[model samples]
Target: NVAVILAGGVGSRAGFSRPKQLVKLGGLPVVAHTIKRFQSHPLIDEICIVSTADHLEEIERLASSLKAHKVKKVLGGGTERRDSSLAAIAAYEHEALSGPLYLIFHDAVRPLVSDEVIDRVINALRHYNAVDVAIPCADTVVSIDQVTNEIISIPDRRSLRLGQTPQAFLHDTISTAYAAALRDPPRAHTDDCGVVLHYLPSEKICVVEGDTYNHKLTYPTDLLILEKFLQSNGGRRKVADTGDRQLTQLRGKSIAIFGGTSGIGEKMAELGERFGAKVSIGSRRNGVDISHAPSVQEFLKEVVATHGKLDAVVNSAAVLTYQPLEALSDEDIVSSVGTNYLGALHVARAAYPYLRESRGHLLFFASSSYTFGRAHYSVYTSSKAAIVNLTQALADEWDGADVKVNCVNPDRTATPMRTRAFGHEPQDQLLDAQTVALDALSVLVGETTGCIFDVERR
Candidate 1:
């Protein structure tokens, strides 16, 4: 299967001086995110990008930085979107006669395309020649008169669907459709599916389910919405369980754990040692204050100096205060934000050089309250949310350098921090610290980044 990323548009609608595809969303360019989806997919055999002439060299550099090995061609596209699609199709024209080929057309701006959508399209191609992805329309559809600006006809909402990308077609099917389309091209036709439907009337174009998060980046506000989506896992649904699996990857690796004096951090450090990792623990008890940049930087510098390298750094250091906004003390607000939010920032900044050198992993901890604000723990909840955002931004920023960044959003856990805030909870009702620690270790060794692992008791 070949993935064709159409990035020819100037994106004047997005109000950017440059094309929106080159705009940085999380940390990388928007097109980089789209390319990564297909590049990492096991089923995708090759990737071809149709970029404008002015940005061709820049896109090539971006692909090279990402190590996009599957990118076979970065051809120059024409003025229209259809012309870009034709360029991708024409690239494989000679090769199509040798064997079967599947072409998946997708917009470079729609970076949130999920694996499920791609799978559905590929599966449908086995039974049908053409396939498209779309979601059921939630809004009412009305045909409006252009000149009078009045409603002409109302279409049933159930019959309406908003089209999305990763539209797939067999090599011969789309080629034949475009060949006929060139004789008298439709003026306003934008999608490949429409061309197939109009030219090849007998060919059936199947519709597959598309995710709501798989939206194209058009307006400026869409950038903020997509960033939030990426922070919230970007349409990933599976929750991982370590289940007593052996972490062989941790053996002989160097790990630095902050807030390792007690609680989840302590448990993680113990497990790291048990698994043969060269563990370096730090906390206020050991003259390491995460809230202080110099203190955190000095600790990491010593860890690297002692261990000879740093493979991973985990920042579980956090302060939680339960108090109403009106009754909270100035000291309470400062401590919570400083330790939880700014501390994560400091750790990321200090650890980047080492992690980038080793292509290492950086992990942070967030609470379940990060998704929403709680009454008494407003500052604490907001700080956790900030941590989630920081993890995603850093993941994008360091993707080219091969540094992985992720966060663990554990539910109410039986930790010393929780006991201090709300004492004496039932053991069964709370997640064990060891369980959460195991999950964190799995993330450190796993290949996923810019994700939130939710640890909930079964």
Candidate 2:
């Protein structure tokens, strides 16, 4: 798959002396940030930048810095937006990319576009020949006549949607559609979806739900909002801990600690407090059962109600049951899965609203058992594996919400549960609770979400 980033816009709407795409955003060019999203995406194999001849060298300089993908070509765009699309298609053909290649066209101004959005568009290409990204209109859309500036026929507001990029398609299909559309006078459309719809009316362009946070940089005020977003996330990215405990990244932040009553969880709460976080606990001992959705919901609600702000939620609640699969009772199985897997869901579902409001972090704990399927603990390991997948899935689902999701997989920890399960692993061979707690907090502060961070083994 390849991404074609269009930077040919004249920046007429933006009063800046230079082009809007070239404008510095969070210490990088707006286009650089836009390029980074695709460059870092695992699926993207190559990139093509389309711009005016004057800006090609500068964009090449910036693209060189991001060695994430092979920049196959940097070509000059046509006078119109459609012209750039043509140039990209021609270059793609010149490269002789294999039959039915996938192409994603994104605007350089929309720097915050997430990998989830790009992935969804590419996934949709499997079934749909052409696809577009759009979000439901929050405000009622009105139709007005431009001639007299009078109210015209009002379409159903419920059906209206605001479109965004990157609009994607099968390289051959969209290029064919564009080839047919270019025969007539240039059509005034903002996106390729219109080009396909107008020329290839028979083909249906699938619409994927896009994120609100993926706002394009058009107006001057948008620069201020993006700048603030950068600062909040800690300078162009999240605050990743570099084993520097003295930094105290969580200072003044409020965090909810599920399963915070004993062992590792208790130590985590204590460390959070020590690191300057206002920590709240959710555990069975505190009248909050993670397996029960309602209890988890109310626990977080109360935490936010008391603290007045919630920055993160760490769900370290899991039962380490050491029993063969056949030997485990039905009730025991249900309890383990519910607490280990569904418990994470309960916290995520319950905390989404508040987390999204604050753009907070959601951290779930997985055990070392997840990687090496320990025979006696089949159910426990399986549930922990599910937690890892859930963390990634939820991260993608909530990309627009900006609520980061991650899983921390720790080795055998010196906790009551470890002693209860395996009697006694030597103290030297067991990871101390404090070490695991700090590593988990590192995940919370880091900008890299949707990861399975493994704590160092003793």
Candidate 3:
């Protein structure tokens, strides 16, 4: 199976100086994320990108940086969307003669296309010649007369669906449809599925279910919406279960842990050492205040000087004060934000150079409350939310440089910080700090990046 990414649009409607596909989302270009979806999927055997002539070189560079080894070709596309689709189909024309071949055509702007959506399209193609992905439309559709500014008819919403991408087809089926189109093209044709439906009436095009998050980047505001989606797990969520498994990948790796004096950080330091990692702990109690930028920079510099190369940096440093907004002073707000939010930022920025050189990982900590704000712990919750976003953003930004950035969102853990904020919780209700630390260690040694590993009590 082959995945063809259409990235030829100029994106005038998106209001971007460059094409919308080139716009940065999370850290890599929009098209990079789109390619990554198919690049990482197990079913996809090869990839081909159809891009504008002007951006062809840049797109090739991105594919190389992503190590998209599956990409077979990067061809120049015509002006229209169908033209790009045709280019992709034509590229595989000769290859189709060898045997049966399948092509999955997807939009480069829809980066959040899930594995489920791709799986459905592939499964449908097994029984059908052509397949399309779409979600049921919620809004009522109106057919309006062009002459008069009046609605002609209202269609039932249940019958309408908003179309999405990864439209799959057998190589011969799509090629035949396009061959007919070139001789007598339809006056108004949008997608390859439309051509197949029109040019070959007997051929049935199957419809597969797409997701709400598989939306195309059409307007400027859509970028912000996509960013929020990316921060919220990027449509891929995983539950970390270390389960007494020892991660030997940490052997000989140099790891730095902030807020390592107690709680999850301390436990992480202990486990890292147990796994043969050269561990270094930093905390305010140890004369290193993460909230202070210079303190973090100096500490990392020392770690590098001692170990020669830093493999992973974990910032579990956080401050949780459960005071209501009305009673909280300026100092209290600053303290919470500085430590929980800014401290993560400081660590990420300071650790980047080292991590990039070593192609290492950077991990941050987030609480379960990051999904929503909690009463009396508003500042703490908000800061954790920021950490989650920062982790995702840096994941994108540092992707090309080979630095992995991720966040660990653990449920209420029996840590000193939690104890200080909320007094005497039930022992069973809180997670063990060691358990959370183990999960963090697993992520640090793993290849997955730009994700939030949820650690919940079983």
lDDT of each: 0.90, 0.82, 0.89
Indicate the residue-level lDDT of 336 in model 1: 81
TM-score of each: 0.78, 0.56, 0.73
Give, for candidate 3, the lowest lDDT window spanning 10 residues.
233-242
Please write out the lDDT profile of model 3 over residues 166-284, one tens digit for every residue.
89999999999888888984558888889899998999999999998887898989998898787776555445455666589899999999999899999999999999999999998
lDDT string for model 1 (225-326, tens) is: 998787676776434455666597899999999998789999999999999999999899999988899999999999999999999999999998877888
The candidate, 2 or 3, that scores higher on TM-score is 3
Backbone clash numbers for all candidates listed: 0, 0, 2
CA RMSD, predictions in order: 4.3, 18.8, 5.0
Q: Considering TM-score, which of the candidate structures 1 and 2 is the better prediction for this target?
A: 1
Q: Return whichever of 2 and 3 wins on lDDT.
A: 3
Colliding pairs, model 3: 27-396, 27-397
Ranking by TM-score, best first? 1, 3, 2
TM-score of 3: 0.73
* Colliding residue pairs in candidate 1: none
